[model samples]
Target: MKKSIFLLALVIVFSSCNNTQKIAEITPNEIPSGNYEIKSIQGEPVYKLSFDVDTSENKISGKTNCNSYSGTFSLTNNKIEIGPLSATEMYCEENVMKVEHSLFEAFSNAKTFVYDNNMFVLSSETGIVLRAFRIVKK
Candidate 1:
């Protein structure tokens, strides 16, 4: 009877450790803790696209192809909302303006986020709109 109890205790301890490991696996995929640069928009790479988020302050700022912008962001669980961004009025070529507009639309419509490895993807209900890669700041 004592041997059976010992075996049961060992099994319980191992199971607990296994559960903890599973939780740890998920922790890395959470909202990343540093700056990230916008790598793509709607599956197309855009020039000079950058993004930064401060999870601690629930704020986000970025530069599009033509202008710099800043805005507030909210995150609940995995859902994300960024909006009401105000940007500089400096004008640019028509193509650059178009890309900037697309970037703003993506951010305004963002509904959720996915983080894997060093990549962060922002998606709307329709589909992914932005993909960003983490930047390790020195």
Candidate 2:
């Protein structure tokens, strides 16, 4: 009886570990489709920038400040890639440019994203989170 109980406990522990690991993996469906807005930049508040994600075309197009930028993006289990972003060359004030640069860099380097309900959070490998809100269509 004691041996059987010990085996049961071991099985329970292994099963729990598997469940935890699975939770860490990001599923494809967790990524939302449609428009989004940047609610925060690098864990700080900033002017909202709208984003439109086309999962079918594997593209992410968005408006940052007064400039529009588009780029290719890919998302897999626990991984995200946004790169090769092309934007208008129009210049802006120093403060606005700083925010634009930070947003662009953060999005470009986002390695993972977590979405719950209509709220989306993008994070880098180092755990910096950029939160965004889903834009409801009229």
Candidate 3:
């Protein structure tokens, strides 16, 4: 009887551990579309930088250190592609140009994005590229 009880408990335990629970993927259609105020790039803090995302139109526009940039982008299965961008030709200070260089590096690489906890994070395979919070419209 003890052996039979042990077997029953084992079956119950095994049945309770259901490995079939599906994790829903955030589809491209669900990618947030709006203006996100960037707070950091390459894990370094910065201010006065932001991106305007229009997912429906596959467009991204934002400010660099001294230039206003526009680009095409796509998001699929949380992976991101930002690029082929054009920007205004205003010369900036050295510090501002440094920030723009970092921004361009992040823009010209492989990236993945996540919108969570009210924060939008763009990351590369090595580490985080930038982090931002969406500007909610009132």
Q: For model 3, how does the per-residue alpha-carbon lDDT over 1-138 read when each residue is reduced to its tens digit?
A: 999999999999999997687845544435577888888888899998888989789998988769898899887778889988898989999999999888878877747888875588888989888888989777
Where does candidate 1 stray beyond 4 Å? 1-29
lDDT of 1 at 57: 77
Instruction: Give candidate 3's TM-score.
Output: 0.75
- Clashes found in each candidate (C-alpha, N, C closer than 3 A): 0, 0, 0
RMSD of each: 7.0, 11.0, 10.2
Model 2's number of clashes is 0
Error of 3 at 44 (Å): 0.7
**Model 3, residue pairs in steric clash:** none
Model 2 worst lDDT window (10 residues): 20-29
Q: What is the lDDT of residue 130 in candidate 1?
A: 93
Q: Rate the local accuracy (lDDT) of all candidates.
A: 0.82, 0.81, 0.83
Best by lDDT: 3
Worst ten-residue run, lDDT, model 3? Answer: 23-32
Segments in model 2 whose C-alpha atoms lie over 4 Å from true places: 1-29
